[model samples]
Every structure is written in C-alpha cells, then in structure tokens.
Target: MAEQAYTVVSDSETTGEEKTSSSFPEIAIGIDIGTSQCSVAVWSGSQVELVRNTRNRKLMKSYVTFKDEVPAGGVSDELAHEYDMLSGAAIFNMKRLIGRVDTDPVVHASKSLPFLVETLNIGVRPFIAALVNNMWRSTTPEEVLAIFLVELRAMAEVKLKRPVRNVVLTVPVSFSRFQLTRIERACAMAGLHVLRLMPEPTAVALLYAQQQQQSGHENMGSGSEKIALIFNMGAGYCDVAITATAGGVSQIKALAGSTVGGEDLLQNLMHHLLPNMDDLFSSHGIEEIKRMGLLRVATQNAIHLLSFDESVPIDVDLGNGTKLSKVLTRTELEEVNKEVFEKCEALIKRCLQAAKLEAEDVHDVIIVGGCSYVPKVRNIVMSICKRQELYSGMNPLEAAVRGAALEGAVASGISDPFGNLDLLTIQATPLSIGIQADGGDFVPVIHQNTTTPVRKEQIFTTVHDDQAEALILVYEGDEKAAEHNHLLGYFKIRGIPPAQKGVPEISVCMDIDASNVLRVFAGVIVHGTQRAPMPFMEVRMPTVDDGHGWSAQALHKMYGSTLDLVTVKKIQHRDC
Candidate 1:
C-alpha cells in the first residue's frame, strides 16, 4: 500500500481552542488499556494497523516502574526478569484499582500484590505506593495510569510520525459513569483528549458488523440480522455482550461484567502451590519482595504452559534460602480456579437471558482477550454455548484495539472509499439512572437497556407544603433503594412558589449524548402555566466527590426530608 497522507482540520465551534496549521494530519488512535497488557492502533488510511513500541512489539506490559526519581512505564524500558517486575518498584493493574474507593473489595484484594496499597475502608481513595531506593513512595492510580498513557502516546507519535492527541479508548462495560470520569481525568493528565470511550465488547461488535457488511448480499433488511455473543476476558476483568448486527449497524442487546480475571487465578494458584505463601512472603523487605516476584513468575509460567501441556514443572529458589519445587497438573489448576471459570459461564448465561435469546439463537460465539487462549476457558465457554468452534477470523489479541481505531477514524470525521469506516454501533445504557424519590426510593427516569443518545424525564413534587426547593439526587443502578445504588450526582432546584404538598410540578430530565456524557436538567412549572416558574438548571452528572458514599449519607442526615421529592402524575406536557 502507498503511504497515505491526511489533512489536519480544527473545528473552532467544538472545543473553542485555536488550532494551528501542522505539517502532518492529526489522527486519533485507538487504545486498548488492558488490565495486564496495553496496545495502540490507528487507521492507516487503507486498514487498521497496530503501532509498535520502541522494542518493535505491539502489546506492552501495563506497568510503570518508579526505580528512579522520575517514573517510567514498562513500554520503553524492559525489565530484566520477572523478579524485577515484582521488585517493589513496578506498579501494575492500575486498571482494576482506578476509580475504586478504599472500601471496595477490589482495592482490598490489590493489597496482596507486591506494591503497597493502604486502605482505611472509609470511602476515600486508597494510598498506592511503590518501593523505590529502600523507601515507599506514595502515588495515586490516576498518576500511574497517566504515566503509562504518556508512554503509549509517545510510542504512537514516534511510529506514526505525527503529533497524536485525540484517542478512542476501550473500557469495561461494567464501569460506572463516575468511573468513566476518572478514566477521562487520567487521559487529560496524560495530555490527551478522549474522543470516545467505547465499551470493549461493543468495539468487537463493531468489527463483527463491518466484517458482515463486507461479506453480505447487496440487499439490506431485517432478514440479514445476525446475533453474536462476544465474550471478553482479560487479566483483570471479564465482560460479555450480546449484539444484533445487520447491514453494518450493530445494536447491543445486553452486557454483563465483573472484576474476576487472570489476577484472581494467579493468586489462587500461588496459594495452592505453596499453601503458606502469604505467611512466607508477608514482609516487605527486599528479599521477601524478591521471593514473591519469583513465585509469581513461576506461577504465571505454569498457567501459560498448562494451556498447551497436561502438566508443568515449577522450580524456583528464593533468595532467603527457600527452595520451592512442585508439579502442577491441568486438572489441579482448573480445580484451584473453578470459581473464575464459573463466573465466566454465569456472565454469558446472564447476558443471553437479559437479551431474551438462547445459545442456539447466537450465530457466532466470538472470544477475544488475553485469557481467551486458555484451554479450560475456551472449553467451558464452548460447552455452555453449545458451539463446536470459536470465531477465528479476527486476532484475539488485536481485535479490540483495531475496532477502536476504526471508531477513531469514523468519529474523527474521516471518510474511506472502501466503506470500512461506514459502520455504527447502537449502544445501550448499561444501568438504570434515576433520582431519589418517594422517601428514599430509586425512581428511574432512564431504565437499563434503553438506547443511547437518549433523553428521558420523570415528574416529581415537593413532599412538604410551602416547599421552595427540591433535591435531584441522581443514581445509577437497578436497586429499589436509592442508597443501594451508585450515586452519580445531585443538584437542587429552588424558587418554587409556595404551594400545598404535591401541588407544584417539577420535572427532572436526564440526557445522554452520543459520547455518553450525561447532563441533568431540573425545573418547576405551575399547574396552569406552560413555562417553568423557575429557570431550569442544567448540571453535568457525577458531580459528587470521589468519596461519594459518605456524601449521600451526610446530605440525608444533615437535612432529613427538608428538600425531598415525591413522584407525581404528569399533568402538563412540555418538551424536554
């Protein structure tokens, strides 16, 4: 293929930032920031191509080593051995730890890793630290992720020979809007603008849709619809999505995901091998950290080898005069991590159930991710789906990033002659979003599975007579009680005319645009007036702080029902 050149154009109407003419085009790359690995790719005019790092490798380890005063990600500098990665200087798995409070179980599990994770279970961000030069240097997950992204951006810039700025990143489907905010914040810290945060499975769905369009008949109708079950399991997360595709349009039907992944499996096998592994390497001394690293490397190798062989031999000598030797059989490894495999199966079943489809209805069972190559995982998924073969057209390791690159091109307003970029994925709301009403109940305005780029509203009224204000406490979940769900943000609508309880009509509107940014608008209108008595106040959702759990409780305790709202029948028709 000949080298293709693009023109850089700036829209002053979009960001209100001035754009200067450049020698090269500004191309937005697709980034798959995985739990254990990360990769970057771009639409190379003709096709999506992976950008190699300085080492000429596509997939780079997702970690940053703070051995020196200035931290460096593993992408540019390779560690000598597996033990060096666990030397208390390298921090990995920031994907799982990001956006989680200290009270989260996932944060607690991270404490088992070689790095230092201090938690208080008080709804604050955890303190993550890496040992550097005989001292523990504190850092945040956001900072670590930013460092890693900076390395990725540098690599892409060098490979593409352009100033890369915008990106389309793939995120887990289970990530809440608040979590999505944190990811964006990290991207900003790395000096990059996120064009879109596409769900990982949905990206794969887009790739599937493009492939079908390329091979389908000329006719475009409902008869050509194809249902695909995408199962994505990586190092730190497992996500399943069911999508319906036809004529290059893919509609997501259902999504299910969890934090269980290869990390959990490795920990389980480590314990099974030594049995007293925790006690053996409980201390954070240099020697103890080295021992932990050695054991981790041995365990990881055994797991990888088990995929192709029946059993593997593991032997390693701890610097502390401890000799470890064992033989791990495939059956024993599976037994040790049965729960992880079971969770994968449950996710697939739940997703299919929610989509109102059966395994037989699925035309293709696509598996993608680092862990998809595992024999046991493949067997369990194939058995559950009752399929004889897995989809083998796309590369398991590169599909997500490639799909993201395609989205980047389309979202950047780039056109292709081959029609590859002429694709769309109709996304759905992964969770219900609503406000607190009916005395602490979660009143959903936008239910789960609702199509995206949507607008919804629900009528609410003051709970007390002569009320002047109403609180809009937004939440995201399917739970009945507001407290049980994840609080996105909240705002207050004041200046209501004095009226009897449940007399004034207040409307709360939730708007999610194409990029999944949410905005909440609240206003009050009198019974006989078409115009709102008070001007509607629009505030972006997830305005709550990082420690939002406590904020919700504090708000309720400080002003108990003083500004609460109750659901009321819609009497006035107004455009939202």
Candidate 2:
C-alpha cells in the first residue's frame, strides 16, 4: 500500500506510549448521545443489541446532578422527583449548549431553563452554574457532558465485562467543526476513545441499508437502488437527510437541519399556558426553582398527553398563591408550535431540492426520534412526502443507537459469512468547508454534500508584495461572505521567501479522513526552487470558540489585507 499521507491519533489516547497486546479489544460500542437522553449498544455476536443500564433502562436521561461533590448521572442515581432534576442541581441540554457562544440566541433561550446561564454576548464562553448547597458552582458545558459520558462508560464496562475504551457517537447534522471538537474534548475528558462520530440520520440510513440488503435477496428488485428520506426530530435538534442505497453501500444525497425540537415545543406550550412564566420563576431561590420545575413537568406531561388524546387539562399552583388552570387541545398545541412544524417541513423541502429529486421519487420515508411518536409530527412528514404510511420496520426510539452499533462492528473490521454485519455508509459533508480569501469572500474548497474521506486543494497568492504570511480562516457554511458563515478556526502560514505580489504559490489543502477528523495543510513554492517535500504547517480545525462571529469581524477590521490571499489560476482537476 502507498504510504499514508497523515498519522491518526485517537484524541483520548495521547500518553506517548504504545501498549502491545496479543489480541485487540472488542469493537467499540455505539452510543447515541442525545439532548434529553442517551443509549449505548454493541454487536452482541449475533446482532446489534442495546445495553441496559444498572436500572435496567435502555434509555437514560441525559442529565448530570452536581449536588454531591461527586456528580451523579441520571442513569444510576434516580432523582426523588422531577423537581429534583430542575432544583438548580442538575444540568441537562448540554448537547444544545455545547460550543455555543454567549451571543447565540439558543444560549439566550437556555437561560430560561432551570440551570443558570449567564451571557455577555461579546464572543466569549457563556457562564453556566448549577446550584449546590445553595451556592452557585460554575461549570462548563464540556464538563457536564464529560460527567455524563463517564457514567455511560462505566455502565458499559460493567455490563460488557471488559474495559470499554472506544465508542462511535451519533451527532446532529448541523454541528459545526468547532462543535465537533467540543464533542471530542468531552469524550477525551471521559477517557473514551472516539472511533467515529456518525451523523444521526446517516446512522439510521446504515440500519436501513442493512435491512434493504437482506430483503433484496428474496425480492425481484434485489439489485435495484432504493431512495429514502429520513426525518429525525428529538429533544434538542431536527434533521432531515436523503440517501440512496444499493447492495451494501449507502450514499447520502442531501442533508438539512435546525436547532428546533421537543424542547422548543415544551417551552412554547409553557409560555402559552402561562404568559410571562419565565419572569415568574426568574429567581433562583429554592421555592422558585421548585415551582419552575413543577411547571416544566406539567408542561412535558401535557405535551405527551396531547400526543395520545385530543385535549389535556393542566392545573398547577405557582407556589406564590397563583393558581393557573387551563385545558389545551391538540390543535392548540399544534398552533403553539406552528413555527417548529413549518421549519421541519422547510427542512424536508430543502433536502429534496438539494438532492435534485421530487417527493414522488422517495421510495421510503423513515421517521426516528423521541418526538416521532407525536401524531402531528408524523402527519406533517407524511403529508410532505405524500406517502400513505411510514417505513415501520425500525423502532423510532432505538434505531439510531442500533445503527451506531452496527457501524462500530463494521468499522472495527468485523465480518460474518451470513452478511449480518456487511454494511458501509458513504457519509457526505453536511456543510461547505472553505477558507476566507479574495478580501474576505467565502471560497469553498469542498461543497456541501460531498462524500467524506475527501481532500481538496486550492492555490492562492499573496495580496501584497513580499508578504511572508497568510491567514487561513476556515469556515463551514454556504454564505457568500465569510463573516456570515460559522468560523471553524484560523491559522497563519509563515516561512515564505520574500517575493513579489502573486509570485509565490501557496497551496492550501483540506483533508477529512474516514473518522471525520479534519486537518489543514499549507505549503509554498517558488518558480526557481523545487516544491517543499512536506507541508509548512498542519493544524487540526475548529480551534475557534464561542463568539467566533465577533472574532471574524475583528480580524478583518484589524488586518485589512495585511496578511490576506487571493485565488490564483487553477490547474485542471476532476470534479469533487
């Protein structure tokens, strides 16, 4: 085989020492790290199976309570009441808050939650605190997620009867590179190696691909391709994807997602039932927190009830002599969350448009997520796809995790003669990735929906004569202006010999490996000298943090082309 272009390092395994073993450990388990809940699974010899926690629960609430000095996850330590979960001691929804800046509207919405979320909106990390012993103990979203993952790891280790080290995680399609880095950081903190970070819907597609492959053996159209539209809406996110499957290969055609989900629905219904409810429970006092928790539980129950019944009665005491009584109908609930449903429909339309396919072309419409059980959600998805029924072969709740487990097995080189684990998912880049060039224009090196394990390079020239450095601001989005896109990170390329403007050729290369790790390499060349054998510098991406938007603006205003580059004439190449 040809020499590898780069070295692979598991983010969590960086001790600078290698351990040899006669046999490798079992394949990494698959984990679905959710906004409101989590699950772990593995290939249990015969098939993929969900691993239950100590409580014998397949799904664990994704919350970390810091009441004690040693934090406890909801999986093993059960809270006495739902109020205890929101008593300012537990931190949930970290998935939504991770890698987000104080300026994000989502962060502002999170302030209304039980935990304390403080923001300055100046491109810095938000200050989050949990009530412990009546004192606010500050913590980062990364810390909260690490704590929960530790609990998950321990549970998996005990049940599997081995030390679990590696895992395949499922993430939202809209997560930027910076957000992905935050996830890897959390996994590192938990002492678990990340084998792969699969997109949520793509994982479902993998499971679907396996199912189609098995059934095709007995059907007439065994070799024909199948098109599927996957709609996944959970507590924290909404994502849609279209995929084409044939044999064992799953090709992702298009993807669209948003930060709307069951949490938004719950908040909307809570506000509708009691206007100014957030203001009512703004105080973090014990009584106020309990009251807020009570309202949240009631709202959650009402939303769930509306899924089964047409109307649900809600009566609660605000703990300050305020009695709120109301009966909410399914129609009213749908009306309250009209925007969310509209966004979901818009996402589907966007995906189909991107895939260049009509609704009639979809052979299967698969729905998965906690909110998939909601009749309204199902109805809207069915109406958009114009399908009389949904693909009911997979379980809505466990499909993603099960798919992840199968991925773990396949990625680990596990195989069977029966073809039970013969699967491959050709994931595509969910967003455009490029560097800022040509006076702050977003020049895409790899467009959205491009297959992964991809590399693309572009040549650029210095804007000013004798410029010795160039700043590469990597961004993810399709905006014309770099400022409008999500800034993944930035680095300066140096060691360029002095030359006239546009004389020295600077090549910037972006590589996304199989495990979704991104690396950027830059090199320089002169007309009279040979090309550099190695890149001048290579940096991992998503180094930007919260307030990246402001950071981009500041860089442009302060530098003003002092260290900028413009696109140069390119050579012939194949389409990406």
Candidate 3:
C-alpha cells in the first residue's frame, strides 16, 4: 500500500507513429479529463460508444482520495458522501494546477479549497498535499492524475476485453506547450500513449462536423463550407473555436480560451455567501477545514439548483456558532460571477474576430460543457452569436469525449463500411511561437491560429556589430513582451561569420506536426544562397521545464542582451 514512484517518459521514448497493422488495428480510446469529472469513449467498430465504469455510469468525479495507505480514485471507489471528497483527504481540480507556476493567480485562488495548496509566490510548482491519517501527505498533480488514469485504463480494459493503451485526450486551448508536456508525462505514468491532445473546443467542433455529416447538413451552404462557432466551459477552463465544416472535415479557423469556468463561479458564490470566508479558514485547522467543506458543498448545491430554479435556499452551520442562511437568486448568482461571464463573452468574440467572420457569418452555434447548463452562460453565447437557440445535436457534457473517440478511430486508421469514419479535424496553433528579439520583444515566427502540420521560417539578424553568436530565446504566447509569455526553451547559434549589425541572416524555422509536437531549427544563412553557412541546430521545444519563468529571468540577468538577435524579413511556408 505504499506510494509507488512513476517513471516520467522522455520525448524520445514516445514516437508519433500509429502502432497498428492491416490485419488488426489497435484503435485508441478518447478521454476527456475535466476538472470536475472524467469520461472515456471508443469507436465500437462502426460507431462511437461511451465506455461506462463498473457502476454503469458514463461520468465519474475527478478526484483521488489519500485517506488510506494506498490511494483510490473516483473511477472505482465511490465516495460515501460529497462531503467526504472535501474532507482534506481528496485532491481534485488538478487540471487547473498542473504545469502552473506558484506565482499564478489560479494557484493562489486554489488555497481556499479544503486541502493544502501552499505557494511561495515564486516561479515554481506549488506545494500540494492531502491529509492522510491526520498527517500532511505531499503529492504532485501528475501523480494524482496518473493514479486516476490508471483506474480509467483498468476499467476500459475490463470492459473492452483488450489492453487499453493509445488514447486521445482533450485539453484547454490556453494550455502552453510546457503544460502539454506535463500532461504527456502523466499519461506516460499510467502506461498509456497519448495519441493526440485535442483542444476542448476543437474536439467539440469535430463532433459538430460528425453530426452535420450524419444529418445531411455537411453541404448546407452554397460554398459547401458551413461555419460554426463552438463554446466550451468546464470547471477549470473556457474555450472557443470557429470551424468550417465540409464533407466531414472540420478546419479550425481560430481558438481562444482562458482558465476561468465553473470553479471561478463556485468560488465567487462561496465568497459572497461568507464575506470573510478567507479570513475564517486561514488557519486550515481540522474544524476550519470541515466548515470550509460544508460551506463549499452548500454553495455548489445552490449553484446547481439556481441553474434551474429562480432562487435556492442555502443553509449551513459552522462549529464556531457561525451559520449561513440566505435565498440565493439566479440574478444574484450571475452578478457574483459577472467577471467570469464577461471573460467567456470576450473569448467567443475574440475567436470570431480571429476567424475573420461576423456574427451573421456563423452557420451554427454549439455550446458544450458543464457551464453550458447555466442560463446566464447560454444567454451570453447566444447573444454574442445572435442566435435563437444552440445546436441540440450533441450532448453538452459528452461532446468532447465523443469527438475524441471519432478522432481515435481516424488516427488509428480504422475504416468503416458506411464511411462514418471518414472524418478529419484540422487544428490550428492556439498560441504564437516566437523568439525574444529586438530588446526583449516577442517576435513571432509562427503566429497563433495558423493551420497545423506547418513549418515556418523567419529571418533574424545580430543586433551587435561584429557579433559572433546570438542567443535564441523561444517562447509561446501572444504577449508582446517575451518575459510575459511562457518560455519554451533557449539555444545559441554560434560560429556566425563576424558581420555588422543586421548583416547576417539567421533563418529560424519552426515545425509543428499534426500531433502538436514542436521542433525549432536555427542556422546562419549565407547571402545569395538558399542554404545555411553551418549545420542547422534542430532542438525540440520546451527544453526548459519546471520554473521556466524564473529561468527566463535568470537568463536575462546573466546575459543582459550580450547575445541578442533582431527580426529581419519573415518567410513562411505552411503545409496543412
């Protein structure tokens, strides 16, 4: 019953090759690891089928309890009561915590949960722990997720009567390349191979494409390309996507998302219910943790009830003669989470604008995820798209996993007689990839929303006269400042022929394959020739992991622009 250490797989160990043959193809399953819940699905030879646990439930809570010497996940272990999960012995919401630095605001907000989330406010991983046998037991987000995934894999294996290995996972569009690496590591720990990490909204878009194909609406428009907008808001993230579907192909035009969703709304309501909740539970004592758990349960229940009823009564009694009793109106709940709603609205609009489409150009609006049930959320999405009703073809909660299943079949090269498996989801980069140039400004070599399986080259020059070397600081984000973005990695291009400022042409090429793996190529180019003066340095992206933000600062301090490059003409060549 002792905790076991998991071996984190290196990028070299996992290839993006399909492990199947003609006689028998190993079809991958789809997994949607939501902040609050999780689900698994697979292609059942002809159609997509949602895999249920032993309890015959399609959905399972996303949490892991460490009360006993060994840990148990929600996949196989049933909680006696909802309050048991909040008893400081269960760890949840790891989707929001994984790969985030301690300086992140989301990490700071998570401290109020009925568990220990200690942060130093520095650029490093936060300290997370769960109470076990009245002692603080430290653990990492990846470990908890691996334990849960192991259970999921076991359940699928038992149900399907085969070894479940390859999987397609749904992730937030806002997740950085570094964050994705962490997710891959978790999958590796569970002895599963990640086939693809589809964006949540993009996965929804794929499901929309499938539905359109089945309903004979694939060519509804005159141009045969129907534009649809997808909005997905789960517990930890909100994502938006605009796609053009035709003949079962969904080309994602744009993607936008943020780390704001039902969790924020829940926290906002909890704070509104108890104005001094933070002060009341600062100590995190046994009694205080119990009280926080009670209040959280009350607030969560009220939120769910207000989604249907106009008003809900919330009543809870704390041990220290503290009580909360009030009539929570739907309007008041919406008011408390005004910022969250606004953020969602902004994301949808941003995605539309990025896709170069107007509200009227949208052929359909698809809203999915747990937050889609909220009337306020529905109104906001409908208002933004100027639509009367959301598309009712797919279930809000199951769209992502279903889409992932479809993708799994396609990626695994499984063929269907009825052509149901004839589907494709063309993805776009969710964040811009660039290098720090021109006095710490982010110079994007490959802009966000660019179609994937792409390769782009941007020419840069040395900033200093007669500079022999230049440092390439890679980053991922849309931020104008390099330091404000997520640093992917850094490398040096040496042996540059001593040239004057802006005289040398350093061609920096970036390649993003269909699986979203990034590899950066940089070398010095000789003028009047289409070749590099030296061997090109090809390095995999996200070389720097763990406390990358702080590493960026340290890099700046040590070098201090001693090795800098400025952007020249950008030459792009894309393959989609």
Candidate 1 least-lDDT 10 residues: 1-10
lDDT of 2 by residue, 1-576 (tens): 111111133444533222433254467799999999899999988788899987798998988887766777777865543756658888889999998888889988887678788888887789998889999888877888888888888899899887777799999998988888888888877877788888899999999998988877653346588999999999999999999998877899998888999999999988898888778777767777777788888899999998999998999987778777988899999999999999999999999999999999999999999999899899999999998999999999899999899999998888867887878999899999998989879988888988889999888889888888889888998889987789988888886777899887888889999878888888786565665534567888878766787788788888778999888866678575
Per-residue C-alpha lDDT of model 3 across residues 91-140, encoded as one tens digit per residue: 89999999999999999999998889999977989999888777889988
Best by TM-score: 3
- Scanning candidate 2 in windows of ten residues, the lowest lDDT window is 1-10
Rank the candidate models, highest TM-score first: 3, 2, 1
Q: Which is the better candidate, 2 or 3, if ranked by TM-score? A: 3
What's the lDDT for all of these models?
A: 0.85, 0.85, 0.89
Candidate 2, position 515, lDDT: 78
In model 1, state the lDDT of residue 351: 90
What does the lDDT come to for candidate 1?
A: 0.85
